[model samples]
Target: MLLGSMARRVLANAEGERRAPRFVFVIQSNGFDAVQACPESIPFQKYADREKFEQLDLTQHKLPKGLAALEPLKGKTTIVQGLSGRSTGGGHSTHGGCLGLYRTSPASRSAHNATIDYELGRAAPGILPWIGVGMSAGQGDALMHYTARAPHKSMPIILSPEKAYNAYFSVAAGGDREKDFHLKRNLLDYMIGDVKKTRRALGSLGGEELDAYLSAYDELAARQYRLLANKDTLGKSAPKLDDRFTSDVATKRL
Candidate 1:
């Protein structure tokens, strides 16, 4: 079990008030195209976020009936394609698809190391932001989650449906959106709390990466903190998430 999983199980016995969530996001990798093949998936043409397909004419880019099964999720997804993460990983075949998910830079040099997932998670490891799943095969070496520049510590991918289900259903140390405010507010507070100690430990100056990394972390914390305290974060305004926001019901040929 992941460390967070264990913590939640232990915390289950505690008595406390329930808290609303700050946000929720999902990632369905290579299997998404396969899932889209479901007759149910065709409705995804209706997805609202980042509607790159909004202008597409179904007749030209027809989806297969296999996608129809995924229709129920049409309004909730952000169907993205051709998003370049990086390039190089395992040549044209083996399984480089994972690397392309979000590397952003060229694959040759853009290390998927400690990707955003980890940065976000480590940013707040308590919540376990990255609920990982592997499709058709195992979780593989690449991290479904990542830091800004580095790939997460490599672990075998979760390649089975049963494994995915188990991970998804397992208990976890849940984070409360309301309670998160203090944590976010204090992130810098806590870090800066020891600024003198940190300075003393590091001596007169810090390196470029450390300085930049700290600034980035601070910016992230401040934004999240302010968003939470002020209730100013963006909503799930995508038309697919809520149809009323959409311009029209997209009618596709396939």
Candidate 2:
């Protein structure tokens, strides 16, 4: 999550402008039946005959049982289908393969390459650029591994609504925005200085690692500066805390 914010800030700092067209990837790990997502009015047998390209008018047809909830917003929604994903490999679960277009192994349990979400996140900048929130049946830790930030690196999903709320709305907590801002600013300044000192005393490989660290800290500092400048606007737009925001349930997190 921190990496995502820093990446966005870095892009803004480099370009001297904020980029439009932000992205949010809502990944559902569980398998979904494609037939159930299609319109009920469309015959499955006819649709399966994929020898040629075809387009269906959803307006004239009733939505499938699974997608009935979207009826109210169907006019605004675009349902895309008939896309081939054979290049990603066939399996019960494509894992990171569907996004990266590379085969992933359960035994390895890590991405062999960077996923599409990370690529888009790097291009678009925001306060919390790429938020990974979802429900999981797994126990112990609330983080459900989803997209990969880089090769062999899995991005952690926040499975708890309470934790996710705290992370996103920490600035609005206790109505002490000025104090929180200064504390973060001071911390970033300290880390930036420490990284610079360490980078000067390191070898080429070590220096390279420190350089990345330095860039992240620099971007964070810049983000802090911007936040401070827009503190009033932030407070005005901040969400109000409620039962939904404080809930620990996995479904609520979604």
Candidate 3:
């Protein structure tokens, strides 16, 4: 009986050690042709109707040329076709509405509702709840809003990997990077103080805009402190800085 109890405890421990599954959404702007991800084993003629639900097991079939790199992970991958978001607007991109399932355009700055990615990020909260990294063809573009947290709220996609790295891992990185991290923390402290003073000066006249500014500053300052508090633990697992992080090439940065 003791041996059986020990075995059950071991099994429970193993189950508890299992990591949570991560969900990743790969989106493409400028109209991604679904044919690019279609399996080579299936003929294009088979999909001409485009009115039926079709599923392909990646493990049993060869991936298309564009997705050839994912061959090794084919067994774990799934390719679904015939899904459409007609309400997202007709254009090269839907901006915020693609994930929110509402009508929005490139000129629109906000979303009609929280996107799936944002909801998932909230459900699986991290030190930084959701980190978005992307690259733009345009030169010197530092960010793009591709996701939304709620109505009138948009998430910033980090276009510069360097900036993203600094935001994520700099606190644990030694040398000048660590110093810079502390410097930013100190700046946040100063800014928080200044914001408090500004709030006092403006009184009720400050309105929601000033309150929003103060809230943003407070959130950033809190993050800085949290990182500093966990620096020792973070240092053990932080990724080492490499050329890929600083690369100018869009693909490499991604």
TM-score of 1: 0.35
- Candidate 3 Cα deviation (angstroms), residue 153: 2.7
lDDT of each: 0.40, 0.67, 0.76
> What are the per-residue Cα lDDT tens digits for candidate 2 across 34-76?
6766888777744457787676767788888777877886764
Worst 10 residues of 3 by lDDT: 17-26
Candidate 2 vs 3: which has more TM-score: 3
Each model's Cα RMSD = 16.7, 8.0, 5.2
Regions more than 4 Å wrong, model 1: 1-66, 69-87, 91-177, 200-205, 229-254
Clashes of each: 47, 0, 0
- Sort order, lDDT high to low: 3, 2, 1
Comparing 2 and 3 on lDDT, the stronger one: 3
Error of 1 at 8 (Å): 47
lDDT of 3 by residue, 1-254 (tens): 53784677678778895333356666776766788978888877445666766566678888999889889998767777666777788676677777778887757747788888879877876565566777777736355456877677677777777787787788988889889999998998898899889889989988898887787788778878877887887888777678988787778875
**Tens digits of per-residue lDDT for model 1 on 25-115?**
3344433443354233245433244445344334334345654443455443334444443352323321223433532424343334544
For model 1, what is the error of residue 2's alpha carbon versus the real structure, in angstroms, after optimal superposition? 50
